[model samples]
Target chain A: MATITTTRDGVPRAASQPTRGRPDRGFGTIGGYIGRTVLALFFAFPIIFMFASSLKPDNQIFADLSSLRAFLPVGDISMDNYKAVFDTVPAWRFLANSIGVSLLTVVLGVLVNSLAAFALSRMRWRGRGFVLAAIIATLVVPFETFALPLLWWVNKLPWLVMQNGQPMWTLGWLDSYQVQIIPFIANAFSIYLYYSYFSTIPKELDEAARIDGASWFRIYRSIIMPLAGPATATVAILTFLPAWNQFLWPLMAVQSENLRPVMVGVQYFFQLDVAWGPMMAYASLITIPVLALFLSFQRAFIGSIASSGVKG
Target chain B: MSRFMIERRGTAVLAGVATAALALSACGVASTSSGGSAGELTLWTHNAGNPAELGVINQIVADYNASQSKYTVKLQAFPQESYNDAVVAAATAKKLPCVLDADAPTVPNWAYAGYLTPLDLPQDLVSKQLKSTLGNYQGKLYSIGMYDAALGLFARKSALEAAGVRIATVDNPWTAQEFADALAKIKADGKYQYAFDLGTGDSGTEWWTYGYSPFLQSFGGDLIDRNGYKTAGGVLNGDAALKWASWFQGLVKNGYTPAKSSTDAFADFVNGKSAMVWSGIWHSGNLSKLGADGIVMPPPDFGNGPKIGGGSWQWAVSSTCGEKAAAMDYITFSLNKKYLAEMAEKQNVIPATEEAAAMVDGWQPGGAKRFFLDESAKYAMIRPPTPGYPFLTTTFAKAAQDIIAGGDPKTILDQAVSDIDADLKANNHYGF
Candidate 1:
């Protein structure tokens, strides 16, 4: 429904209904546009500099620093840095490993965290709150405070491996992808987010599903999970970011070059006479996946960040 | 009800399977074999990303493996930035490779911690090496590098001449007064943004100690009292140290140098932002790009003599290694004159031996960078050789940083001396 109005010129105007969550297009809207454009440029500047510097030679990268030329594709520009980056590190291998590790972490993290959250939020089990509180308490302790102890435990932990056509037990999870993925799968923050989201879904739906002879797990799978799409996406993203940008843990845990993530590959160019252009090119290459993910899920990503209180 | 029973039974079966799998894995863990077995030796290097150094080490490994079948030497290269942490972590896990490289200043600390075993190289090979290249801990040689690095005052002869400053030479480095007069003259000339660049922007802890501690020593103050390796009381905060600190702070106060230099000090020098730069020999290439006007001179004398920090990364055998003989064999094989020259050429550092210097092109007599070799041989003083050197470096770096940022020199140095003494006392004088 719309309201009709007559202007001074005697033409009828149809005033559209104000939609919920939409701000009126007033003078403040113009200010918002300007503010947004400035913010956009502020964030885009670093990426632009990286890409522009990636195209230029090392000396020119420094030479153009004093002027607007730094962010522009001016001067002698080429893909020489790309070639050098390819020569220096196993870019494809590192990227593939990172993608594999990050994807597995996200999928597993979502499943594990959601299940834990469902148990805590939906179930009426005893000591469930205590368990939740304990998990949440871990959020205060940084990973670095326990990294060494975790390393020792991981080294001592056992894993099943197929060796010489036989299932064999292996001691030390070092130099393997499982070590990188498994340790990060059970994140506390992801569990908390899932639990918070799960609590919003009506328990009557669960009651009705149970009355229809649906098991708790079945209800979780067929109803609640599908309803928690935004939370799942948020957890997947949150899980993907840290797992993708992992440096210290992977550096210490994985010894084989084939298991290294792209973040660690950044250090390959940081030698005596660091190849600045190549390093920038490599950074630009690795940043593509994250940018693509953000662009595809921009709305949900923004909402998640806003709700989760994550600044950047 | 039947379906619920079926699902519950299935869950039990799945849990059983998982338990069995974990048990099998546990059995395998129990039977894990000892490390360094099967005639294989693992050697770790801080050369990952550095293709030049990695290539040199790889060639040495290839030669060593081919020359003998007694043991196969496998090389694992880690990036230099994270290399020390990795080594420390590996040591904690008792998973250190048979052979590894340590930065020279940290060698004594590693040796004291039992992470490295003493080297037993032949007397002649040891004698041929530069004194700084040898990692001596409690009079035992534990590690040795293929090359060493020297720091110098990089200048443009034309810039100095225009400012009416005498060109400093190896035999006649600028004295304290002469250096000050030259900086003042250059600053008064107003031809450059600043008279000197002391590489202030690179605040890496090692750079602070490596670049500035030598100045402290030249002022007759050491990071620690070398006689007992017990204290820095008289040495670091003494009258000499205060003089060094005042002189260091005066440069920034008088505007002879910037309080914070550009990140790439050498780049600033080449851009003519500064007339001179206190930098390492690695910038020789960029300096050479200035043509014949480029000059590298020894650090200015601050009463005692001009000085530069000595030592670089050197190879050692881990104490936990079961293949010490094989590790030593590889280390010996890797230290050939040819490899040394190749490493120095690739890294643009000074070759550790006279023979290797002759073998390298730019290291020859009267070559462009021959002065660095001469300075390293003459003026380079190895950092305190006690296991406490790590704590000493960090403490000194903090104090010097504070002094440069306008903290009282006496108070800052006194605090540094207190911290160093406390750490040494905590570690029983670091096995002095």
Candidate 2:
């Protein structure tokens, strides 16, 4: 989370007061409004286009973009596509699965990242820099390179193999919720995000808490975690949203229809005989929630960026 | 406000719930068989849901259940694309329902692995028709395409006329050379730029290999030597390879066709852009979407050539299939004379039996359907049921692209034989 006062052209802030006269502080100037309008459109266009396409009829969807006016078929405002989506794919089940995994990932990620970041920032641990560097170094190796080995290792954990004809180390983690969450549970980016914020969190607070006879764990649970809301919120949004949309790894992991999450289940929409109408409707159904959340909380997220002192 | 207590309570509750839910969601113990306890047998089908065909299949299953006291088949339909991947995963867990379907190609892989069970059939049925058409591995009948297939021409009629070529009769069907000329004409007239480009790389090679395997068979060359007594084609490079390589290269070099669509570019012909696509007879549904007016005919012969290519689909019981008798019963019911008629009427499939074809009552969709039947006596070449089909696809695919890439035709054919041998050698390792 890096906070900086963007140049006036970067984010369009509406005139604080609709122009009566020019203010002494260069407020509400023409340059300001033009900059604001241009910036707003950049973010809004993709969202607006997605919404419009969601409303489009299937036959017209494949038509040329230039013929958009003619493309939207004249028909009843139909929910058939949406209905078809529900009939074929278990949408609510996938949604529930996605929400469950994403929130779980967020909670676990925030704890692991913030605690590690807190210790590195405030405690006097030996080889602290080395530990942090080693952990951060993992970010260079792409997650996909480790995916197969990790999956196999977790699924057929050698310890789980009943070596003495008595089961020893049985994790039995294949195609499970843990399989989906564990690989992504402790994130490098989340730790880095927290570390950068925690470093700037006024060391005086930790010092005062220690003077009050607080233990390190107590300080973390009480003083540090409370003040790091802005960073936590930023991490939560970034981490959980991607987890919600993750399809491939989960698809590889879960085979049972009952176990499939929203992203994996929705893939059934593109059958060899996929009806174009239902396909669009199914796609729209899955994306709508994430898009809505982005729009509503976008301002709060922007504010968190500023407060995290990242740009400082 | 007790803010600390509230935050702590919320976090603890959330973490507790998450742990419980995750445990529940993660563990998957496939359900035990509800069959063999009585007459309940679970069946799985990968159907795109042609209601007429579905009705026929269901009716047969119903008849079997009615006729016997031992089994009631429970059918579950899956969308075709997900079925194979899902079934294989299920097979590992012993969760596959009694019946399954796959593309004509994959049945052999499953059979070779001993995942499938062979069904008892009248030797006459297996020998005269299917013994050669179904894919085999080592020395076993794994599966057979449920129907016969043949490569034919599908040309968007309006697109051809726009390019100033009107194909009036099947008798005037173009040759390998004439087909290239039409492609050139389509591009030159700007009606289309050789709209059908077979996908390049591995798949692109396969397109020419599969799509044009017939060329070799027509020219009296074979992909496998077949060793005469129950064997496949070609000791090494054969005349069929040269015939197809030359034709494929001519198309590639002329730049008359798109060099990059799909290994199977069935979509381009249906897109109303390509003047002609060399494809199987099932492309009617694809062409109908663009506009229903199109013509289908046999591939243009290069001087009264040999019947080079035909395709087949087969079915076999899986090892997991409980009550092999019931499974055989189901297959029998599905392939009974009435069900064969349903395939012809519903899928517009070529019949595997003369009796089935008679029942179809003008089942062919267009001139293409008629062309296939008219030439059934002349040039329908069935792909060899051997370990060699995949190798043939690979070898010819390379030859096809080399011709496009400006390689000498004869040399390209020679090189492909070696490449194919390398692949054959690799497959034999059976390394753990």
Candidate 3:
């Protein structure tokens, strides 16, 4: 066994380490690897089962539930369910709508929320604390309590439309893409997240920029935003998820199938005889994109959570 | 950080917001309308994902639009699961389409809430429809359906024969005792995972009432007293209902059925996991996979004779529809025997009229699907035609779920009755 020694910094150091060519194979490290692998598998089993079941027939899916075959694509498998998904719903159209809506919401949300956060955190203004408190307070009011009233309000709003090559005003925001994206752009939780992260940046940076005759917007755009990558990533993901998974609002607000998102498409398979296989296929199809997005932003998401003291 | 750079950035931000606003404004489609231009009538149906039914509906609209120059009918389809929420939301916004299809039990509530208008189709044409297909609340017809559905006990002939269970018929359904014996015999065979699949895995409250309430009614209990529609006190918690609660729970306790079966019980039955499945008419198509071995039997006569939940999706004109006469004209035109037969054939539901049934392949007299029509005509019991049905259904479903999960049936039933009565009283007996 290599002896461990304390360094001047009070950190443990392996004084006489094992051969440099090979890594340590200690039991603790091995146990840690086992634990991590188990945790990864525990979280991955549902996704694995979903993907596996999506390729099999409905009867075969039930038949394999008793054993490990459920999570493995080992039985008679095919892309038939995926094909059926296209037949059952306009899968590509719904996917495209969701992606566009989610991306736009993320971009707009980050810009709008970060600006609100910067004003609350860096700029000196009267009633700033009350404004921030009010924004945070709205988080406690459940979306469902105001969903109906919001629906009524959106239906009465006026929109600009083109008729016969002339601009005309129309009433109601029903059956539109903007109705889905705009209402979700100014999220309260996102504003709070950006505020917390912005508060951590040293005030001296803003002071130095100000001493050099920088405007507030200039300071926000140049100095503050560049250092808010983690916060931006966190807010982008937070906004994207709800935007992608919107079902009830879109179902009520949007009447056209072409305007619907992927989440609303899931209901298409819930016919009299629910197409379970096709539903799983649609789920897997929609989930893969979100999984990829989260994976790409995994590091920054965790860093933001840690640095900003956000629980999740 | 200079003044010019700051001004440029500010200008860019303002320009970006303006562009985004313009883009968003341009994204809006023409607002949905019940009646537009005095000649266009908008109709909505809950058939978005169902191509077969939607195809027929689209064909009807196309034919109607082609057959007339005065008005054009436009169809918008929504998925069935969330269709109600959409309609309710639209109703709240006072933007309901000219015509929409609503589930049967909801027609009363919709009419009571002033969401539906009394249909103005020809009385002679309406008389030809199945009585259960008519949505009548407070002595006025508010809706009509092209097709209705039925329920049956689907099983394999081979399994029944091997288990020595006598095949049941519409005339002489198995009594409660005989049905219990059959389940016991099937379980004793030990060849299947469960002797019966009650489809309890369907967690929808509507399913609970539609699929199981018939058994409660057969046991001489009901969700509410029909005479007054004011309360569920005696009927829902009475002795007959107690017996139903016990027997329903007993099926699971006796291991005749899983407490919570697979989500797709018909799939499990088709895979030989369950010897029998209590399912709806929608599942009859999949029975063809069993070839001649598959059989459908009437539900057992628990005590009040065999019963099945009735009523299905029915069409109605929204109260806010500006073109009520025009919408009624289109609705009446679509009710022709030709369209009805097409719906019955393509959707595999029981035709709403004998004349329509005569036109369909398997729905004519002595046809393979004729039994479903006979069952619907004889044994079908439409849920209480009262505006309180929504609340009643939810209460009964919760009570039934609790009983299935092994709660004391009497306590749960009593609580359900109390809750239901309180709601009825609160709403002034739902305008009785």
Give the winner by lDDT. 3
> Chain A structural similarity (TM-score) per candidate?
0.91, 0.79, 0.91
Candidate 3, residues B66-160: lDDT per residue as tens digits?
99999999888999999999999888988788989999999999999999999988999999999889999999999999999999999988889
Task: Report chain B TM per candidate.
Answer: 0.95, 0.71, 0.93
* lDDT tens digits by residue: candidate 1, B114-162: 8999998878888999999999988899999999988999998988999
| Candidate 1: tens digits of C-alpha lDDT, residues A87-204 | 8899999999999999999999999999999999999989998999999999999999988998999989877778777777778887799999999999889888888877756676
Report per-candidate DockQ. Answer: 0.43, 0.14, 0.42
Instruction: Say which docking band candidate 1 falls in.
Output: acceptable
lDDT, candidate 3, A207-265, per-residue tens: 88889988889999998887788889889888898898999899889988889999999
Greater DockQ among 2 and 3 belongs to 3
Best by DockQ: 1
Candidate 2 local lDDT, A1-312, one digit each (tens): 223232221221223424357465565577788899999887875555444545555444434234444334443437777777777777788788888888899899989889889888889979999988988899799866776566556655322233445434434365477777877878877887788777766676678888887878999999777766667777888887879888656655554455566776555654433355666666677777777766765765665677554421
Q: Of 1 and 3, which scores higher on TM-score?
A: 1
What shift in Å separates residue A83 of candidate 3 from its native position after superposition? Answer: 1.1
User: Which rank order by lDDT, best down to worst?
Assistant: 3, 1, 2
Can you write out model 2's per-residue Cα lDDT over B1-432, one digit (the tens) per residue? 257987999999999999976755554433234222246666655653234345656776787788877788776554455556555655554545665554555565566555677666555555534232455555666555456665566777776677666573445656666666667667777766564444342243434656666666655566655553122225335555566666666666677666555323554445444567766665556656766566665666665563535554466677876677777666666666666666767776666665666667674434335555555435665555444455656666666666767788777767776676566566762211
Q: Among all windows of ten consecutive residues in candidate 2 chain B, which has the lowest summed lDDT?
A: B28-37
Give residue B95's lDDT in candidate 1 (0 to 100): 84
